[model samples]
Target: MGHERVHLLKKIQEVEFAAVELQLFLDTHPQDQRALMEFNHYSRELMMLKQQFEMQYGPLLNFGFSPSQYPWRWIEGPWPWERQY
Candidate 1:
């Protein structure tokens, strides 16, 4: 579980980074269709990965980024930085 969680989180981070980079590129090049397509693709991919992560483990973020279960899940351990690959 721990190893899988770490791997999944890494994927999420990588996709998110790509999305953000594409967004920045688009900001200066709005006419670039390829960049826009890639940005949207990464955005959707990031959302799916995040959902999978939260469901299998717990909410990946707080302050409305991800919802908690009956009790707050934001406080659980093995947080992103604490996980070992």
Candidate 2:
């Protein structure tokens, strides 16, 4: 909901897109080391983003929801579809 969270969410979205694009490319060029490397990088970033989001915001999925030091305010925030992005 703040500037930092917004920035993190944007980065996570970008990484997600990049990973998906790389996946499509790898489908045809599975032997391409460059594509593999990029995909791994993006995947790592995406994982980190997800973890950070959960730490600061809340679970990215319903199953991941957990109680934090304070009440999980993120549950009250937008669902993925409802988020402005």
Q: Which candidate should be chosen as best, given TM-score against the real structure? A: 1
Per-residue lDDT for 7 in model 1? Answer: 88
Question: Over 4 Å off in model 2, which ranges?
Answer: 64-74, 80-85
**Candidate 2 at residue 74, lDDT?**
50
The TM-scores of all predictions, comma-separated, are 0.91, 0.77
Please list the C-alpha lDDT of all candidates, in the order they appear: 0.87, 0.79
**Error at 77, model 2, angstroms:** 2.1
Best candidate per lDDT, number?
Answer: 1
Q: Write the per-residue lDDT of candidate 2 for residues 1-85, one digit (tens) a residue.
A: 5667778878888899999999999999999999999999999988888888878666667654544446655556665445563
Model 1 over residues 15-54: C-alpha lDDT tens digits?
Answer: 9999999999999999999999999999999999999988
TM-score of model 1 relative to the true fold? 0.91
